[model samples]
Target: MTPIERKLRIFVVEDEALVAMLMEDILLDLGHEVSAIASRLHQACEIAQAGAFDLAILDVNLDGKPSYPIAKTLRERGIPFAFATGYGGMGLEQPFTDVPTLAKPYVSEDVQRLIMGLMPSIP
Candidate 1:
């Protein structure tokens, strides 16, 4: 069997409506379900702490606020995640510099690649 299930539940932390919609469409086409979408830092953090999902796609910034706190929460929960950013590597800092980053204005392929990378190892 594959390393990942046929369907995954993902949480999205993006402030842009259009971008979130695009991501949702891409994930849906990839046979994944979006458990929740948070547009604010506080909301995202709360969900990160209490939400039930396999992975998360966190935008590097949310309304000028960094999404690192939410990312930290996900890490504490042992959930895998990728940072979505337009600034590329320059936008990341310590602790998250090595995490997979999904560049902005992404296509379905880019998102799919990140999702595949986040899959749990079978071995």
Candidate 2:
């Protein structure tokens, strides 16, 4: 696709360090910038509310809680994001029911596809 021009700022919130790192690497490789990375629901909410990201990839669960609050903030600010989870379709919360998502263990191409799907006009 467009390869995400100009290092599009992205926020990645996943509790698993390895998965978060993998996502960060993928985003960087795609020529996008990782504005911030959070591994907890609270941290994700705070960062999302701070308004620094062009987009986000949020895991459905962070620590022991759902990332719904962060999702709410993203929606409130009109920030586009996709849920990333091992649980796939059944993992999404009510408010994020229709939002785009990526299943865990995703390949780089999977990330690219989801990003493209979320921002189709970008390419």
Candidate 3:
């Protein structure tokens, strides 16, 4: 018998349009659905609070504003997420040190691997 794979509904929070688009493409190629995208801190916060997603990929900064508020909201909702940043994991503050991070300029395999690791039920 084989296990069935479930597609994940992912929320993306990124300020840069190009980066966001790239992430969307990567996720799609990885067989995941992007539930929503938020390019600003406030919008991201709102989406984090209201959206139903299996997981999220959040940028550490959104147009010079930190994204901790969105992270907090996701945490409150019990949704697991990873940080994507140009500065790698170092871009995250001390409080977020334990979260997984995908460095900037990542490849599709990196994104796929990270997502698979985060959500083991997905194949």
Best by TM-score: 1
As a TM-score, model 3 comes out at 0.91
Instruction: For candidate 3, give the lDDT of residue 15.
Output: 89
Q: Which digits, one per residue and each the tens of the lDDT, describe model 2 over residues 4-70?
A: 6355788999998989899999988888889999997777888999968788998888887988888
Candidates 1 and 2 compared by lDDT, better number: 1
| Model 3 misplacement above 4 A | 1-4, 120-123
Indicate the residue-level lDDT of 102 in model 3: 93
Give the clash total for candidate 3. Answer: 0
Clashing residue pairs in all predictions, respectively, total 0, 0, 0
lDDT of 3 at 55: 92
Per-residue lDDT of candidate 1, residues 37-101 (tens digit): 99999999999999999899999989999999999998988999999999996679898998899
* Superposed Cα RMSD, model 2: 2.1
Question: What TM-score fits each model?
Answer: 0.93, 0.90, 0.91
lDDT of each: 0.89, 0.83, 0.85
Sort by TM-score, best first: what order?
1, 3, 2
Distance (Å) between predicted and true CA of 113, model 3?
1.1
**lDDT value, candidate 3, whole model:** 0.85
